[model samples]
Target: MGLKSVLSKVFAARVNRELNYLRKNAIALQQKTFTDLVDAAKDTAFGKAHNFAQINNYQDFKANVPVHDYEDLRPYIDRVVKGEENVLWPGKPKYLAKTSGTTSGVKYIPISKESMPQHIKAARNALLSYIHETGNADFVDGKMIFLQGSPVLAEKNGVSTGRLSGIVAHHVPAYLQKNRLPSYATNCIEDWEQKVDAIVEETHNQDMRLISGIPPWCQMYFDRLSAKAGGKKIKDIFPNFKLYVHGGVNYEPYRTRMEDSIGFGIDSIETYPASEGFIAFQDSQKEKGLLLLVDSGIFYEFIPSEEYFNEKPTRINLKDVELEKNYALIMNTSAGLWGYSLGDTIKFISKDPYKIVVTGRIKHYISAFGEHVIGEEVEHALMSVAKQEGIDVVEFTVAPQVNPPAGQLPYHEWFVEFGTPPANLQAFAIKVDKALQTKNIYYFDLIEGNILQPLIIQSLQKDAFINYMRSEGKLGGQNKVPRLANDRKIADGLKGYIS
Candidate 1:
């Protein structure tokens, strides 16, 4: 036990108390957040245009302001981007988190001074919660690394702009500065492969204890480290490493392979973070879902995922959310986004203290033949079979194969990269198909009716996904292959890598 670890335990206790209060008063906290957001922005251009001054409650707000995706809100965002003050919020935004989207192309999400602290605090508290629950804080004294985009920023209209991960790198607490790895110069490398190589050189022999990033990038780092150390596992290179904090993608599919790469199991914390806000974090090792952050500077709304594409979807507040139902997430944040559609879908597993699991992306799914399979379902089905058969799946993606050969019926196609090839590939496919059929009834019905064939697995060569992403110029940072796509864009791109 070092001095830092001792002090962290005491600090963790205090933070836990504050989190408990937030959990206990979840609904009240959300209501207060909603009221504060509306009141603070009442005089802004958007507020005035939306009748925010006359709104008294959720219903009034919903009636006055319609849910908006990026395109719908582009006019106000454009004004803000042109350096206009008080266009969306009371003042100019502190930063713009730039991201790429399918329809909108480039998006600049605001990060107001009022909302930025919530992002930092939510991430900090997630670690503190882990320390409070597990009583293992010694890792605080060792080196930490967050495999992310370059911390470099570009300025537009005097506002700093970059990838959300890169923007967050600027706010890391000063106390952890000395313990953080890959020196500032290394992190600034523009290319990801070069960056990882630089990171491996800097941290392979350091006293690393905590690692954070999305799973795929972290896996890439592990592979680089293993090669640098001549096939030594991650645990051997960094014996002190204890916790892995991951977000932006589900960790389940990569868990087995990642653990094997490390040669042992380690604790992990899942988080729900987006450019717009930090919504939740895994609060307990024993719990299944990430605990929702009601006290954060955001108000949440949900619409049943099935109805998301409808002209007028039914929106429900936090208090009305039901368990196990998929809903498209909506947000009204202190950053000045009002009724903004977040594009992600989530399912509540517990309502007493408000815990949710990221289900899938609203736009990422297979519905060509009306099967409508989601990210969560396909992941669960494949991982379930993988676990049972001791298979080491590196990466995978699903797409609807709408037009196959002349005689073959249209079906879902799965492209998978396997570390250890299965003995019987066709038999393995049948098992995965059965597992998916159990998870999605529509797919089963389609198969039974001869409307579609069983999903075909396209075994991919080593680094197939990496090659595909690299070819598309999305090789690193926050870019990830979608788990499911309605079109053949990704499936067609992956054809060259088929084993």
Candidate 2:
């Protein structure tokens, strides 16, 4: 066989080897991973303060570490920012990745020397796994475009700081960097508009065989590229483009738009990496959910979503998890975060290979009128209706219109940005509403009891959500419009927007 064929086979073999090993020892590996993490941070101040030495296994560790959001860990992270060693981990953090969450602004998550590799390895393996599964490794020989935050990292308290993607960009293997598009200078432009313009100009003609980024920003890039190339579909511009690796947001709403941009179907790989750790990734072509990373430097725990808001929720590990139930993801990583609530929810779709689907954020859902609807339901509802009506959703958010002005009743409000609108808009809303009522029993009951009126549908002007995000000063780079809000704060803001 030729050298290219031989190399492709070798890459497949390597990834399959890891996959086989994981399949064989996943349970034991998960158990040992928790042990390793506990041992590593048992002596840190945060660990010592929690009496980590006495923690022997997942149960003890969970009881001792206490599930924490960024706010709960802020004080300890602030100490790490001040040159403190062994505060959470053994040494000072190499950098702090800054993220301004829509609900909570300005969260600084620490990235340690030990935890950085997990991010890099998980991302690398995700691609490798896809390559092996599809038997397509030739794309590695060509250029790839990664729409990441500016590679220009800022400094705070003598520690490097930047977006998580920006930090990962810094660690892209040097060989691969040679083919990555949007040169360093272009990526450094802080203003997203300027950066995107420069990116379109710089590499619209490059031999790009791969593309990776958050869905919305990448969609923006694709649209601009098409516009600049005289209405060329992305596939026409980069004929060799083979893979689209996406993360940082659910890709469902953007799927139709992205496919339309390319003008053809393409394979995609989804990753569940966060600033906290690289959690899970799509490891199979036939599979529907991400395979949980068993050997990554992070250990996993799950709290059932129903009990997540309880005074004391049940947190379980791999051995005890069940299928088809939504659970809040809790993680402990070698990176010094012990029992941190990553704020995301997931549902296991498989047990043999240990795969999961991201359900949504712990705090991101709508239950405004006693109709508890989670992210998974909303996404499924949108995707179902969009597919049935042959439309493409750009972005959307749901909020309940509570407190009726007079004789009217409270109902759910849907603000949808559609790329393709059905001719009958009334039927479109009816289909979407019926889909939600089917998925969520609570919502169905409200409708049945006459406690809630029919859902209202408002067509969002194109880029309405984008404009709202831009107004928030968070136009791109991992920033997303929250899929569901508890209150009308975001809904009202979007109403006042140009959309």
Candidate 3:
């Protein structure tokens, strides 16, 4: 290995060692003073001008400071955009991570310099955890491919205006950096069309080992790669690939399709990445749930999902959190967000303090048809059916659609793609329908003709859904197919291939 590789290995080793030390001493670390956390947060842009006095102190801060949704912080975000340093924390934010809000349109989330360490540490811990679980740290020594957004810094009026990814790319260790294939292979730097072309070209003949990114985009890239390789399997192209790191959205639907397209059984490592912060990561084994990076320059809170939706929403601190209960995740990050609800739901899988599973998005549910189907429930039902009926469903999307006749009640339509045809496709569909009915009571009622028709299964052609996403200009980067659609609009839009 070269000097850079040697240095990176050393750095990675040190980071791994530190993470193990922290994990071994997690209980003691959890006892860290809230005052110190608040003080550190104050030093960043988020806490600078905010009245810590209003909340009194750390104890009162926890008691009185209500959990805030993106809407509640809109004014603060606006203030930051207007050059108000106090609202965003103190120093000028380096960049704004542009993200889509559920009700709100586009949001530009501020990221500070101090928050960079947290992101890096959390990501590193995730990597180390994956290594510990899978015994595959050796892959890190090889060239890893990050299927991410463009690293090209944008230029407005001839000056460099970089996004967060571009800024972070510069800080990646030179050894790891060298191993990275040219940006053209994975980055959407130029216009969308041009970026796709670049990605196709750059990934042409690389010995990529570890692939990481959103599922939809990664799948699309593989589709293109598969086409270019003239129907050759993914193993034929990237023979060195060992793992697939995915985050940004749920991976259940795309998991089967990915393995089918890639022609291998590489492990899938899920991540809990948000514009606000890199919150958690899947251990390498891909069996245990994600591990939260608690001490990574952020203070966390968990409001019970019911309380979050109640008339008088109540919040809970880390100390009050219980295992296996669903909660709306909130965080006070080094990035300056205070009591910010991430708009995601998670359930503790283990009491080691940080092991949890991303259950679902708070707003991503299908209650329109009275099914009360959330992402996790749907994923579980789908996985169960797939296992019982022996179907290898790669990717899927479920939406409530008005089918058969206009006045008829809506039904859940599932678009699925399989790797190998099950012995009984009809029986598989029946099992899935039954699974949905049993697991989700609302779905059961709907199937009983109280609200809707039985679930309809659509088996898509190989790589068909991926092409559809690419055609919509949402192929790569952070975009992924929505698992559950509550309205008929998105459902109807996907109607052409109901076979």
Candidate 4:
């Protein structure tokens, strides 16, 4: 083998060895907590995992730890908010990560001292892997710009409490942190509107080499920057930018638009970050999927997607999990989320259990009119139609609206917002219908002489939907227009423009 191949093999072997050692250690360390909880639940007979009383072995553990959603943890969260110890873990949490969902309002998620290391470790490993994969460790000889939240701590009752991103930024390595870039603390901390101009001004002549954040916000920043620079590209603003890192949701929809807005083909990496913890990250290659930080401060359980919707869900241990299978993630973290379900679905793409791809959100499924449609199916259908019709969508959300008709099944009404609208809207819609029908037989059956009709396209004015979201007090942050809604509530909310 050549020297490069041999070196690659050596590095892979080291990573594998470290992963194995960590996994083995974690099993023993984590079991202490798991066993104690199992005993306590058995004793209480009313706790969440009380059903696991019958479990004598790992099989019992799998069967008994009932699958739970965020709603199920409301009481625990309340306790945490009230400063209760051991709500999910053993001590007072260091901070609370703020997150929200379609059903849940702003959630204050607890993060313990132990879990902080895991988050940091996962982020570091991902960065190192990226460096190794791209052989670009030296690319950031210049300042690294983190397009993140502000470092200004929120004041409550005259005391300083910080946002999650602020706290994380405070801990970033001093050497790696940008000295020239705008302070997220001063510039991007307040209302997004106030932050946008500062972001534009700060980045105008900076030597930013790395940019990281959610895609939509990054897009907005670049758009504003381009406009301020008299239509100059992102490369013109920061001529040395070498890498872009983004997470929270899929970046596929905004990838092309972002590239165009930036006017350069920089390396891109995606991360799977959550309020609970930094779970996984795309390695350097960006093609091998994300590596799960198994040794980091979290213990993971995988529930097969097939069994996800079942009333009683079964969880598989990481030691025995397989690749290419859809699994609902269960996390037991130092942050105190034992057997807690994060409501995300992922599939392993590599033999290493760490390498995974986030498929979709578990609650983001639609079954209106008895035709069950999932995120993967919808994304696939959209991509297929885009390829067939030569349309490029900047972003889109699908909601199943019921149109009940006499002697007919209910059909889906798609609300699509495209960057490149097709010349023949009807043809594009028909192509989408065909794509869905081909992928899902149920969709085909629903369409054949039934109530379901062709997919409808509503080409929105550029930034129209974004403006709407901003008006709703939901823009400029982690919030993106949700992809799929089970019912017509969100869809109806977006009416008037649906043509």
Q: What's each prediction's TM-score? A: 0.99, 0.97, 0.86, 0.86
Ranking by lDDT: 1, 2, 3, 4
Candidate 4 lDDT score at position 444:
79
True-structure Cα RMSD, model 4:
4.9
- Mind giving the per-residue lDDT tens digits that candidate 1 earns over 1-499? 8888999999999999999999899999999999999999999999999999999999999999999999999999999988998988999999999999988999999999999999999999999999999999989999999888888999989899998988989999999899898799999998988999999999999999999998999999999999999999999999999999999999999998899898898999998989999999999998899999998889999999999999998899999999999999999998899999999999999987899999999999999998889999999999999889988899999998888899999988999999997889889999999999999999999999999999899999999999999999899899999998998899899999999
What's model 1's overall lDDT?
A: 0.93
- Which of 1 and 2 is ahead in lDDT? 1
- Better model by TM-score: candidate 1 vs candidate 3: 1
- TM-score computed on alpha carbons, candidate 3: 0.86
| Pairs in clash, predicted candidate 3 | 45-88, 45-89, 45-90, 46-88, 46-89, 130-284, 253-395, 256-394, 257-394
User: Candidate 1 — which residues are off by over 4 angstroms?
Assistant: none
lDDT of 4 by residue, 321-373 (tens): 78877888898666666578898888888743357888887778776655666
Query: TM-score: which candidate is best?
Result: 1
lDDT of 2 by residue, 337-365 (tens): 87788889999998888889998987888
Kindly state the number of residue pairs that clash in model 3.
9
By TM-score: ranked, best first: 1, 2, 3, 4
- lDDT at 16, model 4: 47
Residue 295 accuracy (lDDT) in model 2: 91
Model 4 whole-model lDDT (C-alpha atoms): 0.69
Tell how far residue 254 is off in model 2, in angstroms.
Answer: 1.5
